[model samples]
Target: SIYRMNFAASLCKRVNIRELVTNVPAYAGATELSGGGLALVFRRWATKKTAGSTKNGRDSNPKNLGVKKFGGERVIPGNIIVRQRGTRFHPGNYVGIGKDHTLYALKEGNVKFE
Candidate 1:
């Protein structure tokens, strides 16, 4: 005789940068998860900078500044874990890995990953 069991699993909605920072528990600027997972975080702020003059010489709000990078160790559950090398981007936008890795832009406002 054979017995069968069915298990139901739920998927978590992917969270955007803003929501990831505010909603996730113990969320720091940048965090490395044990088990080969990485979290990139940032805050909202604005500033003005000087750029090429538009016929009239003047400074303007040319750039927006925000958190650039955060560092942490990678861990393995129930085992020894090591921090793998990685790279982060500015504007609290994206993360890249390995040489010649393609760049990804973060969603503007609250974004959800599937």
Candidate 2:
């Protein structure tokens, strides 16, 4: 289903999303807001198993290594606009048309939209 797919995409450490039609910079880019243009941004992250060695020769504790950002764009309906990408669409994220453009963050294997 689209909802599940969107949720999986959001689970990715880094993602780039853009609105169709107008190529406006959206989330993850620029400090200022464009108001009516779509935007897309990419985010990336690295992780480590643990800080200490375990009996199984593996790190039991996990740690965040680093993160990177990328840019993306998409077209809407018929307009050929290049907007910044928004958060990766997810099940918990806002889906559908019009005001359904927000993605919810995932926590404890569950999705929570803001």
Candidate 3:
């Protein structure tokens, strides 16, 4: 009995899976309902997102979002630090920016935002 229990535990350890899930069928339901409370058609509804206008008169484009990477953060060669729409922060050694004002690292080093 102890040997069998140990064997089962070893099999469980060998098959070390974290989780298991079952695939669900969409857009379909049971044709015949056991409970007599099925009158309407069972279907999935779709949702839509609305992009409302801003109260401030400025257009939402070219937000000039600055500083993806901050000061003293370790970065590898060719890591994008920040993406912006304008020339907010200039590039230094081992750092560069694109034509669209996207700042990135040219070399592997610690980031220094100034």
Per-candidate alpha-carbon RMSD to the true structure: 38.9, 43.2, 24.5
Cα lDDT tens digits, model 2, 1-114, are 999999888876463443323454434457554545454444556777778756675566753221111123322333212122443432322222223333222222222233
Better of 2 and 3 by lDDT: 3
Global fold similarity of model 2 (TM-score): 0.18
- Candidate 1 TM-score, C-alpha based: 0.16
Question: Across residues 1-114, which tens digit of lDDT does each residue of candidate 3 receive?
Answer: 999999889877743122232233454356433333323444667878888987887665666576767889988877889887677777888777788878898888899866
TM-scores of the models, in the order given: 0.16, 0.18, 0.42
Candidates arranged by lDDT, highest first: 3, 2, 1
Number of the top candidate by lDDT? Answer: 3
lDDT per residue as tens, model 1, 7-41: 22223445456644434334543344432334444
Cα error, candidate 3, residue 89 (Å): 0.3
- The lDDT values for all models are 0.34, 0.37, 0.70
